[model samples]
Target chain A: MLKNVHFGPSVLPFLLVLPQIIVTLVFFIWPASQALYQSVLLEDAFGLKTEFVWFRNFEELLSDPLYWDSFKITIVFSFLVAFLSMSFALALAIFSDRVIKGSGAYRTLLIWPYAVAPVTAGALWVFMFNPTLGIVSYALSALGYEWNHQLNGGEAMALVVMASAWKQVAYNFLFFLAGLQSISKSLIEAAAIDGAGPMRRTIDIILPLLSPTTFFLLVINIVYAFFETFGVIHVVTAGGPAGATNILVYKVFSDGFVGLDLGGSAAQSVILMIIVISLTVVQFKYVEKRVAY
Target chain B: MIENRPLLTIFSHIMLILGVVVIAFPIWIMFVAASHPEIRMTQVPLPMLPGGQFFENLDIALNRGMSGMDGNGVGYMMLNSLAMAMMIAVGKIAISLLSAFAIVYFRFPFRMFFFWMIFVTLMLPVEVRILPTYEVVANLGMLDSYWGLSIPLIASATATFMFRQVFLTIPDEMLEAARIDGAGPMRFFWDILIPMSRTNIAALFVILFIYGWNQYLWPLLITSEPEMFTVVMGIKQMLEAAEQAPQWNVIMMTALLAMLPPVCVVIFMQSLFVKGLTETEK
Candidate 1:
């Protein structure tokens, strides 16, 4: 989309674009190519020699039970995060939209959590649920149940999900509120003139109309859960309590950086790249075809 | 206004209040934890109310290191984070502005190719290619440096695409007016485009600052030296140490310190923050 009446091209345009191009190539393009290249090659433990083993890394990963289990964990984690955060945000947005007083204050109070780093969010959750000293755990014990994330995988998963979802609520709330605000007042008035209750109108009109925002947020949230929650997992569980919370992104880091499995980690990276590319495609399709982007 | 719905209004207030409480709960707890003495913080059913040890803990957390790690004070880490965030925010905006200007103004060979190259970067986040990227950073001899912390992350496509979007919306009349005055391309960009995109640039500055400050994994990967540890990454080390010593007050203080600047930025520049976030991300 260039301007029709524009200056002639020369060294100026190249100079303008050179910095971004250079950074992108050195950091983004080269590393991605390296990941792709290393995914197929098997190198010695000491880094002396390399062998090109076509698809063995992929085959081994597919066959490995832990990898498969983490795949399931990623799906379950992303699902819970998306569902919980979206529903919370939608509910809040609905109520926020219905309010006549103190709405801006409520919005401000709710949206500031978006500023909290995920790791800090995780740490906050960890403190609140710290089995011995945590208030929540103490409250749970008083309620005739025990809470200890360090030894229980289910509890660990719940802790992380809460932390991740908590951090996301602010973001989702902003979008959902914007989506709610953008709906025409006439539509709701028309629904009300027909004597439809608020719930009915929301369920019938608002929900359906908000689906595009919903779908867009669903993809955005899932992508967030898949990639951005590394810090959360790292800070909260380290994929521990017996590898219960090991999502794919964390696995890529631990495998490549910690476990020293070059081929395997690179393969995981390749797989992750594929996932991201597909998600980006989905997002672009929505923006191009459905959403008002 | 359509209908009074007094009952619904009350329910709405209740829901909004509950939403605010739930959203603020964890942060409140973190603040209270940061205030109490370490011994009190370790007590069961930790104090729901804040204690007077806040300034004391803040003093220790700022000057001395946390419970476990040594030599990387919260003060230094915060400074490092500020530097990194400022660099990343400025670098991304500067480069993106220049490129967006070029893309929208001039028709050149490989223009589409360059646009595609920037677009493709959106799909390749640092998480996917951590190892090779780390290797690249190491080879560049930038590891544990501020440049190392900020530069590779600057290679992202979001800022470029955002500036491109911003530039496209600037009316052609502005450029035409400037050109009829015999202004050069750079002259027009500096005089007209810069002022026109000032708000967008400021909003983006806020978002990118937060993004750069909240960065965890990249810095965790590249910076092995304790002195180079950022405040956010340093929290992990402190937490690990807490498992043994349980310095909840100090650790939580660091956590609060780590998050304060970004949170303050959001609260202060709210409309701009929301504009930047919704426009760029969605």
Candidate 2:
């Protein structure tokens, strides 16, 4: 009777959300399943042309040098972009936390880049880095060093990473700043009164308290690296300088969409899902308990 | 609140000023470059100061080849972007709020399962399933349609998750009071829950608006008709069709124009933006 009583009211609410359930099922789950299924099959333009190939595609991907290169590139790029962006963001957040004036203006100006479309951001950055007419290129020349991303693999990857990171720093800073603001002033005052140095106060009080924000940012940054950077890379590098910057998503995009190899692309997508899920699980297992509320 | 620490304050200001410069310099550079003509754009020493042709470039940039080629015009693509952004934002927000309210305040069998289902969607980005998604929409006969672009995005798990979190923060007593006053679940949500969540809704609107505005890959894949291309697509079209080097001034101008909507939204909803970020932790 008690179970029925609770269930009665809940039924209406569930029905209220019927549209979302149907939509998600029809749109998200169905498509995802289709992709997963296709990963193991050989599909032609008309439809699935071959029977389930089981692990053949996976084996092929593993054996392929280009696949490994892309996989390695993805890992290195994610870490470099995530770590450097967060560090710069933390510095900016700490600085903004101290502002008593014009902080609003500073914040509005800084977050403007995040609002720019990724394609537009790519276009703008490429314009600035244009070897001949680019102000940035000229500046580098004046400083007695040539900067050409088109020719160098390492430089190309680094330039894409830096551009992607710059787009995200404002977003990370926003969250970190909010975390800083939420920490009680009294805690900082107490730490100061106890003769804690600025560094000591930060390490002891602020860092522990900011763990939740950091964890959230960490998850988000990983997701952004996996999903968002493809557009920028497509524009700036086109996975160029001999496909040196061909990260996983870009590879999937090029292979699946551009190259018209749907089955291979689907295989790559499955691999990507596994990587993202495992990485997410690993992160939470290691750090979830440490995140202080 | 710390007192008589002018030296510390000075040090902090120095750090802040430098931080601001690093953050804002690229945007300032883009704006400065947009102001210059094409020849000046490629000059050995690029102009550090804003130039006079800003409006002229903006004029040519907004009116040229229907796709913003030939150093002129970006109007049609901008409209496509604004329309698509509106459809995605409003549709996603409305459906998410309804779904979130249902899951939060309603009691039912399999409630936890339904909630988990939505939560799981947060992990499956559309990009991973782009090919299959295209198939589903294609089967629905939605290719290149507004419905195609908007519907796939409207059932967003992230927004539902956010709304659920925000609704969970509302005091249950208020909801109980509404129930006792003969209000139905929908009425209670409309009168009490909705009002309490206005600020949250505003912030989510801004975030989703920006997301829709920035869409590139989906728009490119879904639409082949040149008339249907969004601003980002138009920019790509322009980049490819440029003669020798991309007309930097025109490209920068178009980029700036594409950026204005979210910039305006963020400035107006600035308070809600911070509030939404802080409230997520709560």
Candidate 3:
């Protein structure tokens, strides 16, 4: 009977993924291969003629100051957004973990921001930071400080960072809250009985136990900062005051799609893919083993 | 002791209240600005209270300058957003449940490989091969159509992973019992798996719906015609046309309206959303 079940059940599994595999192959893998091909080909200024010019686009990108600047901006933006959001989330999770009363309401309120699409969030933030109409700008003026994202590169960069961080902190909070709930209460009690204070226990015990959650969050946050900020950046500053806020992916969008420079866009995208994939591989090799679960 | 406890509680209350204000302020500002007139929007220390321009703004937004290639109306964009979101959500749910079941229940060749493929897609950002994907769709003549919008997104690695995880939670004994009762794999899946995974399906629906609805760039690139554009793309175009000076009240009103669908889904599916997160951690 077991042998009789073999061929039929085995075939069913292939059938399950067949549609998805085909669609992905046609839409995903095929497109990616085409993009790679395009990256090596030279295109005329008007985007009509193309010639195979292997590695020329990549070399140009490597030598371009603007490309490197955008790359650096991307890295700084991703790390800052991830770090700040994670820190805030950890703090909020710890605070809300202890007090059960009204916790549901708090979680719902906190997570509401996560539900808002990033574009809407960016638009809302842009409005709020408007010099004349935005409450933030009005308050800043009242407090005797100037703030205008349109003109100041630093201010524009800060606004983009803040907008990205705001949407993400809630997601980080969700994971941290989940992690906190899973931690054995007895561990905390044992530490307390051993005369360990909350801070000490949290540092030595809680942090180690929650490392898996933190690591997962780190990956998610980094990917989000790299891939997901297109909407936020587009709406908030459009890579503002001299392209200071222009991250890598946004650059790809501008060059490939807006400027119709397919080769340059593909080259930039290849670099982005390499950076992300290498980081991910490193995480899997080194960090995955340490994940407690 | 009572004095100290009250003070601590008061402090906590203050902090919580501050959190509420910080979270709600922007949303409040959107509403407040939407209700005020254009000239009033220029007033410094912008109005603390909502005014009477809300209806007027809505009238302009819903009715004005919609004469482009795409019928310029909020309703068309709403329909596009709803249809695309629903199509993706339903399609993803169907594919995920089936694929997950096949992987979990039956012994199969390359099971681990297929599983890894799904997980690996999660690791990839969409931008990695977006250009080529665009080429494929364009070549297939799917551009400027809803099929172009829905198909590529319908098969989500995240949803597949989620469903596989969910299916693993079900006991083997249940499947064995169904088999003993002469229920075939298809029948068992339809009756048992669907009902059991209802909550998960609902959760996936909300997430995928929100994702599809919020998609801007892909749709913007693929569909150049205005009538076929999603609300998000419409909003971007609106911002682009605003150029030097934007009408804040109209912009705020439109944004607030655009936000309603996702907000409604989140509020309506609160229980499932919380449960979905809690279960994923497990």
Candidate 4:
């Protein structure tokens, strides 16, 4: 992919790349390798003693019920977030496509939430669903629901899921809108002439064509739910009420940073790194296929 | 659209309205909460309409922040966030541009090696290696500084890749003509390439600014000093403090202020934000 005409090797290129290499080495590589190294070492809670232990940390982690619980919670949370955000966004994108008039207004109105921080989103939702003063909780009580996420684990998980999904809906909406708009109008027109209605055309013609975008967003949303929803859980639940809302990332933080379980946390970190690498590999493989398509 | 039916049109409007309402409801609640007094906010069936205490709540949050310990004003936190965001956005664009330029224009040893080095970083997000990265930053004595907040996060693979993609598509004739005129590499970059990639840079800046401003985990780890706290992360502290002192109005005001700048950028520079997002992710 090099240009046919290029400059000869010189100190300029090295100097240009020096900053990135140094930062990447120091911050990214060194630290990542440190996590790998720490995964195999057994260290006490205090900074006094340490010993090299092979896969015992990983073995202990595999046996730990809480870690397994966190794993299960993360899967459930990620799917809920991906499903809720994608379906809601897809519905909105479909409907917005139907109404040509004021579509820009609707898009502008809908897309600003992408700018909201996950923590800020959590704060807003928690405020709304506050057990004592939150308006949504107040409304729920009138409906005989008695919403108290503070003490209830299921409700806490739901609140974090809602906040996480809420911020992501904007991102998914933008992509879905772009995907829908890219479809040829002639295809839909053809379907209409063949007596298929709007719903039928959407189900039969549009959804099939939109599969690539859907697949891409599925990967993106899962990645978002897995890694990026850390702040949402931190603010809303703090992995509390018996760690019900504790996704893997939050578990990494709490177990490492809060619990000060160095080896266990490092093992979690290593596991997370593995998860990210696999996700990246899968995403790139599919993306190459998408590029060819 | 294929010949819209009247009933379908009505249904579309209804669905779209409902969607917008659900999306905007929490934000509207935050705004309405920010306007009313603290006492009004504690009651059930909260007011749907805005009250007239917006300025008063703003005054409290800006001038005398919720946690009233030193250096906790929302205004100061907002300034901290602005500086961090600007540094990250501008710093990432600058370095990514230089590295991309170097990789594309000059044939050098270890070029592909360095490229892969940058690529591998895409897998090592700050979250995954939180403790070790914290140790590195702590060892470097960068905690509580703007460098700690921005620099480690600024070296990005996606931006570099975006710029490489931008540079690869550039017509080679432009570089040939510049070289024939005896233009130096820096001159060619500053004079020609920068202007050519202006929109890409601006779009990247908008997205990175939002990304930087919205950072919670990294900033939370690095900045322990109240003066160093960013507005986005400061909201959590405020929320925690509110459990003791019921300053609901003040906290909501802080939340609104925290979300205002980036939301304004997205709403106003909608096209650029979208461009940066799609291209950078590529």
Candidate 5:
């Protein structure tokens, strides 16, 4: 990607790149490789003895029902988050795009949640849904429904999902709005002229053109739910109600830091690395295809 | 104005208003909670409207801090967060600008290798390798320090890529003209390149500031000391403490304090934020 007629050869470039390279090596690459290495080695609880067990940690994880449960929970949680936030954002984006006036005001109102931290979002929702004094739960009780996330697994999952999804809506809305703005308006005009109603035009033309953005947002949202939502889960449920809300990332933290199962946690970390690497590859592939288009 | 569809427009406006209401509902509740006295918050059917204790609660949260936990006031934690966010945003922008400039302007050996190295950091998010990274940080004796909180998170691939893209779009004639005037590479960078990318840098700084401010888990992991706790992570401590005392008013006030800066940034610098977001994602 370098330009022609660039600067002559010198040691300046190496000096310039050194800080980033050092940080990457020490923080990112080293720890990642340590995870890989530790996944194959088992340490005793006292940190006194170590046994080199190649692949046993992974094998053990594969057979563990709890691990599988966390895996399943993560998938369900991420998809729910991605689906809920993306659909809501897409709806808002479509509406905002259609309106000719005050679109910027609508955008300003909608997008500030992107700046709200997930943990703060979690606190807000958790307060609103607290079983005893929360106004929302108080209303729910009036309607003959019990809303105790602390005791119910399903409620815990739902609470985390809502908190996580709420914070992400702004991001998805921004991208969807950008995508909508980028689409050719003449196509919508032509469709309207052909007697296609607004709904028909959106379904036939707008959604198809927005697929690339939709796909990109889907991946990004899944990634967000996967990793960035640790704070939400931590602050809201703490993976409680029988670990029903414990996703994979949380499990890695709990197992390693809390449970002291270093090998198992490292194994989980390695698996997560694989997942992220694959997701990044998919995003790049899609980006390349979009560029070609 | 493809069609004069009054009914559709009315419906669209209604739905948008509804969307805004739902999105803003929790925030409204948060504000209402923050405004009331502590005793009122614990009573049934929590006040749906604001009380006159808003500034009082802010004073308590900022000065006295939440009881039954580390007594670090909300004001102090906000300072920690501000410092961390500033360090991360500035550190990332600085390093990324240098690396991007080097890669774009110089034909150096192992340049592609370094680029890929930086790119790989994108995949290894701190969440995945939590224990090992913490171990490394602890081993380096960086725990509870600002450097520990900011340095690990500063190696950003997206920023580098964004700057690279920005530099590539600049015309080559500027560099040539500068060279003809006997300007050194660093001089050209200072006088021309950085000035040209000023808007991009500002936009990126807005996004990164939010990013650094909003960090939760890493700060929670490293900053064991009360003084080092960021407002975002400190909310967790207050939440945990609430399990015992239920200080809803003060905790809500802290949450508001934590969110205020970044929310203000996004709202005030809306266009720059949008630009940085879209460009970085690319």
Candidate 6:
């Protein structure tokens, strides 16, 4: 990755890299290693007693139905988030790309949500859907439908998914718009001359050409829903209504910090690390393939 | 664009307007909520329009803060968030620039080792390892401090990689010319390289500033004291307190203030933000 003509090796380079190296070691590597080590040891809540029990935490986690439920919830949550956000973004991006005039204005109106934090988005949505005071809930009630996310697991899941997906649409839209822009206009023009309608051209040409962007956004959105939506869950549902919205990341937090199950939390952390590593590997591989193309 | 179909153009515009409205609806609701009085907010049909109480609520939320909480006003929390975001963005950009320069310029021992070490940080987000990291920070005596809030989160692999990519694109002749002119490494880095990559640095600063400002769980874990609470995290505290006293006006006002800066940055620095986002992800 270095340049062909590089400076000579010296002590300065070490000093230059030292700050990054120190932070990575102290914050990232050390704590990660501690998680691995703690996974193999079972300790009491007070840290007074400890027993080296290799793989027991993992065994218990694998066998625990609640952990499995959380796992399933995470899978459902991420998939729904990725699907909802990506589809909405793709549609918006397509329309934004199509319009010849005021496209920039539309984009400006759309992309600011990228800067809004997940928690803030959560607060906004939760406020709008508050059971007693929320206008949306009032509307739903007017339509003869009950709306109480605090008491309904399904509603809780839906609320969180909407909030998480809402924040992510801006990011997916940018990438999709970029992808749409990169396609040669001559191809579309030729198809139009060949009597292809707009819908037919989009299905046969645009979507296929934008598959790479779609795939990339899919992975990124899943990872985001997995890790970054913690604030949304924390603010909106807090994994409430019988743990319906409690994803794996929140579970690790509750199990470790609230339940005082250190070994179990460490095990969950190790599992999450594996998931992130695999997703990163897949992303890098696809990126390399894209570069090769 | 291939053919000017008037009806299709009209349809596209309609769909876009609808999409924009759907996206902006919650924000509109937040503003309306923020503008109304507390009693008006608690009513079944929350006010759909902005009320006269906007400045009055703003004054309360910004200065007096919410009651029954830690009493740190939104103004103070916004200052803390600004400091934390600035430190994180500047610190990440500074350290990453140095490390990237080193990796690209000097062939030192364990260069690949250090590179991979930084790369590993990407796979282990703070969420996964929250407990142990919290323990480490607590042990280091950095809790309830800005250094604690910013330093641990500042070791950014994406920024390092982005700078490295930018450095790779720089012409070798610049470095050769600088060397011929007897300019040392740091001098060349400061003068030539920094100037060339100014756009990239600015773009990355925008992305990292939002990232730092939006951080929730890390700040929530460490900053227990009210004075150290960030505005984004303070919104959560306000939400928790809303269950008891239900000060929806002040709480919504605080939420509005919390999201305003980053939103403004993204809107104003739209190009740089887009550049930073695309380049860093790549």
Per-chain TM-score of candidate 3, chain B:
0.89
Question: Can you write out model 6's per-residue Cα lDDT over A1-293, one digit (the tens) per residue?
Answer: 98887888779999999999999999999999999999999998789999999899999999999999999999999999999999999999999999989999999999999999899999999998999888999999999988999999999999999999999999999999999999999999999999999999999999999988888999999999999999999999999989999999999999888898999999999999999999999999999887655
Q: Mark the regions of model 6 whose C-alpha exceeds 4 Å error after superposition.
A: none
lDDT of 3 at A289: 72
lDDT of 3 by residue, B1-282 (tens): 111245545555566556657767788988998898877877777887899988888876666632232335566777888888888888878877777777777777787777776655554466776677787888899998889988887656767767877777777777777888988888888999899989888876777777778887778778987778887766666667655666777777778777888877777787776665444433
lDDT by residue (B1-282, candidate 1, tens digit) is 578889999988988888888889888999999899878976777899999999999998999876556744689889999999999999999999999899989999999999999989999999999999999999999999999999898865777888788778888888889989999999999999899889999999999999999999999999998889899987898888877788989989999999899999999999999999987874
Report how far off residue A139 is in candidate 1 (Å): 0.5
Q: How well is each residue in B45-127 modelled by candidate 2, as lDDT tens digits?
A: 77878999998888777776423344436787788888899999899888889888777776767778877777667656777
State candidate 6's TM-score: 0.99
Question: Candidate 3 falls in which docking quality class?
Answer: acceptable
Candidate ordering by DockQ (highest first): 5, 6, 1, 4, 2, 3
The residue-by-residue lDDT of candidate 4 on B60-147, one tens digit each, is 8888776554544789889999999999999999999999999999999999999999999899999899999999999999999999
Fnat by candidate, in order:
0.83, 0.59, 0.42, 0.82, 0.86, 0.85
Model 5 captures what fraction of native contacts?
Answer: 0.86
Q: Measured against the native two-chain assembly using Cα atoms, what DockQ does each of the candidate structures obtain, in the order listed?
A: 0.84, 0.54, 0.43, 0.84, 0.89, 0.88
**How far out, in Å, is residue A233 in model 3?**
0.7
State chain A's TM-score for model 5. Answer: 0.99
- lDDT by residue (A1-293, candidate 3, tens digit) is 01123224447778887766666667665666677788899989976789999999999999999999998898899999999889888877776776647878877787777767778788888878876557898889889988899999888888888888888877898889888888998888888889777678879988999888898788778888998889989988888789989998888888877787889888887777787777677666644475547
lDDT of 3 at A112: 70
Docking class of 1: high
- Candidate 1, residues A1-293, lDDT tens digits: the string is 88767788688998999999999999999999999999999998999999999999999999999999999999999999999999999999999998878888888898888888999999999989988989899999999999999999999999999999999999999999999998899999999999989989999999999998999999999999999999999999999888999999999999998989999999999999999999999998897766553
TM-score of each: 0.98, 0.92, 0.91, 0.98, 0.99, 0.99
Candidate 4 chain A vs. true chain A: TM-score? Answer: 0.98
Collision count for each candidate, in order: 0, 9, 2, 0, 0, 0
